[model samples]
Target: MKRRDFFKKGTTAALAAGVVPIIASSCATSKAIIDDRKKDKWYHLGTGKKAIPERKITKDFEVAVIGGGAAGICAAVASARNGSKTVLVQDRPVLGGNASSEMRVHLNGVNSIKGKAERETGIIEELLLHNRFENEQESYPVFDHVMYDFVIREPNLTLMMNTQAVEAIMDGNKIKSAKCWQATTETLFTIRASIFIDCSGDGLLGASAGAEYRTGREGKAEFNETYAPDEPDGWQMGATLLMSSKDMGRPMQYSPPSYAIKYTHEDAHPRRSFKWFQDGIWWIEVGSKGDIIADAEVNRHKLMGYLHGVWDYIKNSGNFPEAENLALDWVGSLPSRRESRRFIGDYIVSEKDMTEHKHFNDAVAYGGWSLDEHNPGGIENISEPPSYFHYHFKKIYEFPFRSLYSKNVSNLMFAGRNVSQTHIALSSSRIMATCALMGQAVGTAATICNKKGVLPRDVAKNYILELQEQLIRDDAFIPNRPANDANDLTKSASLIFCSTTTSGDAKNLLNGISRDIDGNINHWQSDGLNAEVQLEWETAVEISTVELKCDTNVKRNIMMRKDSKNDELYGNHVPIEMLKSLSVHGRVNGKWQDLGTIEANRTRLIKFNFKPSKVTAVKLKLKDTYGAKNIKLFEVRCYA
Candidate 1:
């Protein structure tokens, strides 16, 4: 049954079971109350029946993910897939957060590092690739539904849209339940869970739970951050209002709305030049000095005015004949936010940690995006550059698990912009795809928390290695970390060999690294198609699953761009280098037997499962790629 269909027919489902109070009619007081209820219904033309509808629901789950953005989505999905009963609560009707239809910010990760993208894999990559086939039209609204389908299809996940988790019911220092207000149905949801992850960007749930947090820039002396302000201040980074324009075949007349603010090129910063104005301008923004969340509405109004004023200059200024035929197609009323509510965790990620590439024993995720911090005053400060693209990472840096959970609130954790990070560190790590990685990490950690009945701090302190291993097993890349899962039988193979050699050695597949990075190759590329890689065990081993991490060209991005850019840095379609067709075979009693074959594959991590068989040798027959002539594979694993 559809999850939301409980209101219609599946009301008896245990999770959404209704507990409405009906008149018992056993006493005079009850009869009097029933008479009043009947009188109230009679006032409504008797269509409302005998009782007032109860607009509240109480449910239980193992994990509760607050926010439906990239981070929250990843967190909820990971929690569910990792064996936790998870609930995904989104404030808006659609998912994707800033990248949603309301605010069309692109989902960016380690977009470019020295001209090559150390692109994210795992859930984020899977979502983008799903959009490649499902949202080929590249419409933001359609992409929203694509994300909706992805989350709801997971059997263990429950999605609640248009629900805002506003209040936290606390049990001492831990959050026992979240009082979420669903706007659409006027129903309040009390979601009880053992673990609570706040990825809502603004982090209302954590704040209500008394999670220690701070806002605005930190003083340089605090963390010795070169990019930090001279002294601490309440100057937080701002939000942006985006708009798109389309060109008509003929000249289109233009008029500015009355509320539009007047604009001239003379006052704006030189860096704010219209580079990709055909899509949406990113510099049209505003920031706050105090509480940014409280000022969201006031700032949103000003942003809409500024957006139209800029469009007026483009459409009617007559400064450029090229824009005469162009007309505004989409203007966003909602502003895409950047910074607010930095929760305090055991370890606060500072500028130097990212710049100097500080190693963390509990690193569970990695990021390489440039430290692109926007100007303090945002577009309001016309003299300053829109953003300072501070330091670009030459290589990826580790993100610690200690920076993801609350330092004071025992049960609260965070995964998005609200995570424990100095403002300078957030400048780089706030990218959506990077946040998605953090989400996946914390989500997986939530499952461990449930299994052991521990808090987030305990997981970081003691069970970190187990958490890292599970993350690697789930395909999340952590810098300087390699998988050493003892159950993987390929590492125990007596010999590993390849039929052909063109680039990397087949032995590298057992090295535990899944991707080539830092100018090093961990992959084995066949000189030609129809190649084979064989693993021989000294003794017959029982196995039922073989997994391969094939190349999907992580050096280039595949996320949907506003312009649908298909260039060297980005691809509009599937990666041609991906292994499209492959078959696994096993040798039993010195005779080869078919294990499994996949004709059309879509994900970078491909798996083949069959009945367990004891085989002395196993071979992988690599056939074709999506387009490339030769196929490349980074790692392989066999498990019973």
Candidate 2:
């Protein structure tokens, strides 16, 4: 018998013992099987074919990021922005991972209060800003090509699509290079880098390169999580393929293949299964309750069949009238796995860490999403009560940076759903928004490591303060704001400072005001003037330095007069120094005429003597040199 036939016949006994028959026998050709088994039996055979042609090695990079998902893209962008030569490797043609246009899963996170925006920064925020500009009137599924283009356009980033990292070339404890296989031309190539990031989600690099990792849940005592079961188990949350349907005037009929499994009322809460829609169609989710990696194909077929059956029920069973005209729109090609291999880093984030709201010396990321765990199997509907489901916790929590790097591996950093966390902790951090933050943190850390000529672990220990400052500068929210620590009395005061435009159309205040042709300083003098000012108070305290920030490039000075029983412009015009490219400062009383440079892309701070005796009411004169623009002032302080 032929090799393919021998394997097919070999599976007969397993089938006789109740294992599902292999569908590849009919669809897979001998040549395909031989090609797929070229490496090891551990590789997964799937629907996608790689498209990039392999090339010979000609360059080296500071950082290499595997998997073009949200985490990987952010990591690459952050590393590159920090002046590192970065390369991103992705197997798929586009970026965004599970939240990509191909997958179409809506991104979710902790919703900020009304009128308040979540503090998301770095590449993720830039992407959102791009989305905002591209789709001004409405929200759209962020196009995957846009994501790919964003990375490609960056001067320091090189994106390698249709490339799969097959093996890690290790030198002692560090990864020296990676061997990648391009499916399009059946070619292999090698990539050499100083640092490697495993954003592959499945911990593929870590596992292949002998990094320590965990696969299943730990006992409750291990993590001290109340939601965790008392005893440890081998069971893990499964993977799912999301599908949807569109209205087409009449319900489309679909029939399952002969080999497809059928569902019965006794199959555990089949009644809860129903159709809903988003983006373009009414939808339903179907998944594999067993091994995600092992049963990917089986789950794909079953999910398709389940989707069709759902439409069939709507059309023939008269259960859903609103969906009678629904037609199949799209089905996910890649399975979204909830749990798989997790790299064991220096610090494994446990449920106890989350519950206690542990503040780490090297905290890099935060997750507020609940601890949601799904059941292993035996039920088709995820909403079913006992086995397959989701659970939640009361509040949000923080995750440390040490959990992102491997304990055994020297220069490797892990991001996304594969970071070092227990099963319960993974549930909350698995969301794409949180994962993007993890990527940003790792990318920032990678840049610091490269600059300091150190490992990721070393960066975490020695340069953690620098890392935190960089993250804060990039707008990633650390628990406390640095400005809050500055000594400032008026920091607690809420005052409305106004600016008038000269010649530009002011549509949205957030968009900012222009100095030319819109209006003039006179336009801001009257109540209900063309320009308005609003101040929202955060906190107040005494401080010694004050900084001002503006949205546009301009030379401006803020002349301040104290608001006391007597108000006056104090002495000579306290010449606010044009400290940096965007900021201005001056001592409160000394040199009111001469200004100097401070810092670039940072708030400008000014210091001067304000002896509760010398001044009562101080007046400020506002002037512009580079033209009028909307400005923001912060970090105001008064020394005790």
Candidate 3:
């Protein structure tokens, strides 16, 4: 019998006999297995006094996130940080899905909107900043390790690589457990969680639980999306195969692989022309009209062939002499996907919602990338432009909380491209950092579900404001949304004044807007490096935490780009505007007490925690910045 058949039969027999399979070495002797199992282990009748180990394991979590891409990683981290024991399961060996080293796609968000990046913040910002600090060399493989470190180091979170959440064990409409297959260990993992978040780009876990998901394009009539196709179709956006080339000291000979498809770019669309040839061409992509996930393996092979074919043309066509010394450095085998099963939700974000900036009361996150819809047939359709940038937004748009969780699957939620949005809306929100914001929103919601013992819909109906408050408190910017945390003592302070101000007022920090956007001045910029912001109360107040949202120059992109573009919109290194040092002093017994000091800050949200003390006044002394002459701060909060 085949090994798969043997395992199937073995599992059935073990279940029927009510025997626990000992998970020892598969090569262990029967006596050793029996000694471990206490006569309760499974038996293979034909073997001499035999017992075989079962390569299976069971785990439990408050939340289980399927997919370790940008969305899933943010979800897992947010959940774990917000008091939920979380597990992040990924099918690949690495954490970043499309942005992983395997596929060197740029980790893009609102890269450039009206010539400035309204970059994503919160957990996603933390990860990107972590990369900037750690991977100064800018190696893609090192970035994979940076992400791995980011997830692995988090408490209350478990990172499972090479593990795919293949099936969902449902109890009524709620997912009770996720049946996952870990290929590397040859063991199956059953992860039971109160809430399940499927950030998997293909959304296999949510689908297995009978989620109400729709594949293919939605017609214009359905969501009233002007950018949508006139009629519904099965054409999803294509997955791209990326490759990079390095210039060798000596000239490198080039030849096409056997499977390479012949490319005659004589009549190719002008827009599809390569801008940066040394970096991989984004147009080398392929898509399927139906079942993109099922056709992944086949598409990957074709993408490989197409990638080499394009490189062959560049090196040997004699059209460009700049590539004489260029040799292939990295060739991506995995085709980073664009669209698949979009799980339905309470609200389907359509084109008008984004273009007209329709506001949702339950807004949890925001996105501002342009509506860039790629042509259907990708490289094969050379006559058509690679992408149709249908619309651009001057201001960011709000993403509703209702569009995150499943409409039918009570405990199931999703982020990334799989979240419920019309294809038109997805054209903008599908960016990795944009999806990461959704992940943080859903992940925080999962904790609320576990805490209240309620479903996702219930949270939207009753606790949405609370959810928004928490998201903002965590430094996630919801466009046009101002945080009103009642517990924040900063609001009760009698006076808040800066030592010196050049641009914005010290009062703006208390306005609860974390970023300067939509033509609003929300930050307080100091005239010089050595400045003090004092907050005084009428009487002594107990405080222990001082959270300040400093400037990381969100206007410029900090995420890693393949081309390493360092223009005004895209920054290659850390933002010089970041505050490098800060010291806090509290007035206790009429004496200035040294609370704490942060020498070198690396994040936008700088936090200082010390022993709780009753103080009449608190003063924050700001020191040097990373590079800027003046220091800018978006928010400041005081809490016990």
Report the alpha-carbon TM-score of model 3 versus the true structure: 0.92
Candidate 3, residue 39: lDDT:
49
Ranking of models by lDDT: 1, 3, 2
lDDT score for candidate 2 against the true structure: 0.56
Could you tell me how far off, in angstroms, the CA of residue 352 lies in candidate 3 after the best superposition? 1.1
Count backbone clashes in candidate 1. 0
Error of 1 at 371 (Å): 1.8
TM-score of 2: 0.68
Residue range with the least summed lDDT across 10 consecutive positions in model 2: 4-13
Q: Give the deviation of candidate 3 from the true structure as CA RMSD.
A: 8.3
* Superior candidate under TM-score, 2 versus 3: 3
Question: For candidate 1, what is the lDDT?
Answer: 0.86
Give the winner by lDDT: 1 or 3: 1
Per residue, candidate 2 scores C-alpha lDDT tens digits across 258-285 of 5434443343344344424322221233
lDDT of 1 by residue, 1-640 (tens): 2111112111111122112122111111212111222233322455644566566679999999999999999999999999999999998889999989999998888875846547899898988888887877889999999999999999999999987777788899999998777666767678999999999998878877888899988989999999877878887788999988888978998888777877787756688888779888898988877778766766777777778888888878887678888888898977899999999999999999999999999998888888988886776676678888889888888999999999999988899899999999999999999999999999999999999989999999889999999888888898888899999999889999998989999988999899887678898999899999999999999999999999998888888778998988889898899899999999998999999999998889899999999999999999999899888999999999
Off by over 4 Å in 1: 1-48
Candidate 1, after superposition: displacement of residue 61 in Å? 0.4
Model 3 CA deviation exceeding 4 Å by range:
1-51
